[model samples]
Target: MKKFDVDSKEVPIDILSDYILKNPEKIYGIHHNKMEELVGSVFKEHYNCEVHHVGMSGDGGKDLILIESDKSIVVQVKRRQSRSKTETASCVRDLIGATLLNGSRDCIFVSTADHFSKQSIKHKEDALAMEIIDSFELFDIDKFMGVLNLHTSEREKLWKELIEIK
Candidate 1:
């Protein structure tokens, strides 16, 4: 077992996993609120930013709004409900639209999908956000643990845990 941070404080992944597994209904409660809490928690914890969730009714293509210092970042969290490239590209298009609407050049598209299509990736590079991070890189403990400087045997544990929650 290895620790990961939740609020700038390190906590073990296995302990977190056990909590979710034992109280599966708690996962249901989180999903009802969408991943806004998860994304906001991570960003706020790691980046020291204030995050606001714009609800579904009129989100303007952005789900979470992050503000740090003078910089404001618009984030669109793609839930990976569909596995189609067209759908993924469409989400990219929405992020571009969000940039246009928000008048912010700094935008990000985060998704649970394994990866975006080349078209979506290019579109992200060209029109919309400057960054795209999917489940593989974001949740892979081995990869991200390097960023966090933590070593762990549960490489894909976060992904599996989040998917189970979802």
Candidate 2:
């Protein structure tokens, strides 16, 4: 088995993917805050944005904030225990509210679940149509891995990482 420092400031996605394949349990067993950190790091690296982890009590619905020039994006992260569990509409609603309250123009809801409930997708579309939010994005485990540009093999490991927990 191979090992890499999960606590490192900048862990390359490929290396992290390799490590996850070798130790799926280790990645799946990370604390919620650590999962937020990992997600933040990926966004920072992939989008060249500054990420702030606001994962704590009374976070006001956002776990991470991404800043790119004049634009700031609020993000809510859901680390579900099971991939079969679907993220609900309320999560999207909370993120939308948080983005508006935070004075940001965009929001993203990230989840480890295999998918978001149809109601969640509808809520996001409704918010967009009403111009309640400038933009909203939902990222499941697959989309999360896509953002990191993980190869198919690496992406499979992520799915396995979630599955092993079940």
Candidate 3:
């Protein structure tokens, strides 16, 4: 494995992809709770927000809650890598329910799928303050590729922690 230093840098997507492909199943097949933590970490790092993992046994409604300026952004992470249109719709509906239950207006559904069906997208758009982050946008990969800079050492530590998390 390569080590990263403390200078702000962008780790190439190809390199990260290659690393993921090395043990695709293990990395991708992590449990839902672990996935929530990974997603929360990504958001926390990218948005400079306080993220709390609330998705264990009795997670009120959301998997994580992102606190930013007196606003609580409820997040639900679905590990379903693929789902039909109806299933996607169902997931959105669930997110809506979670939002209402948690009394949070801002909500986000993060998934490891490329995209949701058109109907699902429309449904989410129609809902109140709902945002979907599909697989491609799941980790702000593009932002990471474009401008987001992280100390190489921090990035390395994050990568190591992600992969090593059971």
Q: Best-fitting candidate, measured by TM-score? A: 2
lDDT winner, 1 or 2: 2
After superposition, the stretches of candidate 2 with alpha carbons farther than 4 Å from their true spots are: 1-18, 21-27, 149-166
Model 2: how far residue 85 lies from native, Å:
0.8
**2 versus 3: better lDDT goes to:** 2
lDDT agreement with native, every candidate: 0.53, 0.79, 0.58
- Tell me each candidate's TM-score: 0.57, 0.77, 0.61
Query: Measured by C-alpha RMSD in angstroms, how accurate is candidate 1?
Result: 10.7
Residue range 95-130, candidate 2, lDDT tens digits: 888999999979989888889999999999999999
Error at 146, model 3, angstroms: 9.3
Give lDDT: candidate 1, residue 148.
29
Candidate 1's TM-score reads 0.57
Instruction: Give the CA lDDT, 0 to 100, for residue 140 in model 3.
Output: 23
Cα lDDT of model 2 overall?
Answer: 0.79
* Leading candidate by lDDT: 2
List residue ranges in candidate 1 displaced over 4 A. Answer: 1-32, 81-87, 128-166
Q: Record all residue pairs in model 2 with backbone atoms less than 3 Å apart, i.e. clashing.
A: none
Candidates 1 and 3, the one with greater lDDT: 3
